[model samples]
Target: MKINKEEKTPWICDKCNKELQLSEIKVVYLGGSFEVELMQCPECKMVLIDETLALGKMIEVEKGLEDK
Candidate 1:
């Protein structure tokens, strides 16, 4: 239930017009941050957060925060 990690390698960045590289980036929500693997624009540092990661892990974290 995650984005195409292997299928979408060497992505083309929309902003920089450069090839996106697989890298680790930090995602922040509700004053918390966590590392996530993603294809990102190396030049402009734009991260492509997948729908599965957002709907799955991100939502779960938000819900956990609410319950705390």
Candidate 2:
């Protein structure tokens, strides 16, 4: 899924109070790793995984790996 930072409301980091920027982050799951653009805090390096993503692509990938 493509997350356009410009189209959505900006997310704030709870710890750093910094506005989250769209960043390329490394994601690891079921022994697989890949880069995905996500909302992140520059200061604390915190990544936000929204519910839709957690329940959507991530879940699908997890099931696919399990089936493999």
Candidate 3:
């Protein structure tokens, strides 16, 4: 699905405060149209979605790391 560029908000890694890129990241659905960007830094493990919403489902195919 084409991500809405207008809705593509800039994400900064909490660990390093570095800006994220779509090509070097991923979106794990956590319900209510929220998502998680599974990055490499340890801080990336933090929930990327709304805290009020319960985490829905996470699917990882091919067993490849989000960032090469």
TM-score of 2: 0.75
- What value of lDDT does candidate 1 attain over all alpha carbons? 0.84
Candidate 3 lDDT, tens digit per residue, 1-68? 88876885667777678665433344544232324444343445443443332332333322233433
Residue runs of model 3 more than 4 Å from their true location after superposition:
1-7, 22-54, 58-68
In order, how many clashes per candidate? 0, 0, 0
- Local accuracy of candidate 2 as per-residue lDDT tens digits, 5-63: 77966799999999999999988877767678899999999999878777877887888
The model with the greater lDDT, 1 or 2, is 2
Comparison by TM-score, 1 against 3, better one: 1
Candidate with maximal lDDT = 2
Candidate No. with top TM-score: 1
Clashes of 1: 0
C-alpha TM-scores of all predictions: 0.78, 0.75, 0.27
lDDT of 1 by residue, 32-59 (tens): 6788898889899888888998898898
By TM-score rank, best first, the candidates go 1, 2, 3
Q: Clashes in model 2: which pairs?
A: none
Tell me how candidate 2 scores on lDDT: 0.86
